[model samples]
Target: MKSKYKSIIYSIGVLLLTVGVLDKLWWLYICTIYTEFEECRVAYLSLFPERFQNAFLLTVIEILLLAVAAIIFSESKKAIYQKKASKILMIISLILFGWSVFSLM
Candidate 1:
């Protein structure tokens, strides 16, 4: 793809990321609306317990890993036209990858 298309790809990425992050709020709202349901209460706590939803560092690391994989998928020589993405992704991925590895240590 031409460099011009990179913006579209990034925009879609941002949209998906926003939706993913905001889903928790929506889930909470739903559970509250259905407060009388035993299933809703159980599912809400089991699915979004404090420990799971509050794992910010782990979530960021996972998102970075996914981004690195996406860059590799697009920038691989086989992708040809798709490889037009700026190398900034590669640089960012490298730094984040190192950070994540060190964090896991």
Candidate 2:
């Protein structure tokens, strides 16, 4: 596949990961959080609490992972090391997917 197409796929993957992280955070708050939803809303709006910040950070990490995957996919076409990098990226992605699912519970 062309590098451009690979790049687009990488971007989409990052977006999906970001959305998943955000949803996981929300789900955690709903299922396990002690604060009321209304209180959470107020605290988040006024204080930008640590939990919210952590979720955003997780999203950023996912974006970085996807960016790395894009580079690996693009490079694999012309470099011998690309195959190894792709395998590593796939493992990382799988782990992240598992964590995301586990977070929902």
Model 2, CA-based lDDT: 0.54
Residue pairs that clash (backbone atoms under 3 angstroms), model 1: 1-81, 1-82
Model 1 alpha-carbon miss at residue 24, Å: 19
TM-score of model 1 (CA atoms): 0.36
Which candidate's lDDT is highest?
2
Residues 37-67, model 2: lDDT tens digits: 6665454444445665564455555555545
Quote the RMSD, in angstroms, for model 2. Answer: 8.7
Q: What is the C-alpha lDDT of each candidate?
A: 0.52, 0.54
Backbone clash count, each prediction separately: 2, 0
Per-residue lDDT tens digits for candidate 1, residues 5-104, read 6557555544544443454455567677785767654565565657664445544645665464446534542345334443444454455456545645
Would you list the clashing residue pairs of candidate 2? none
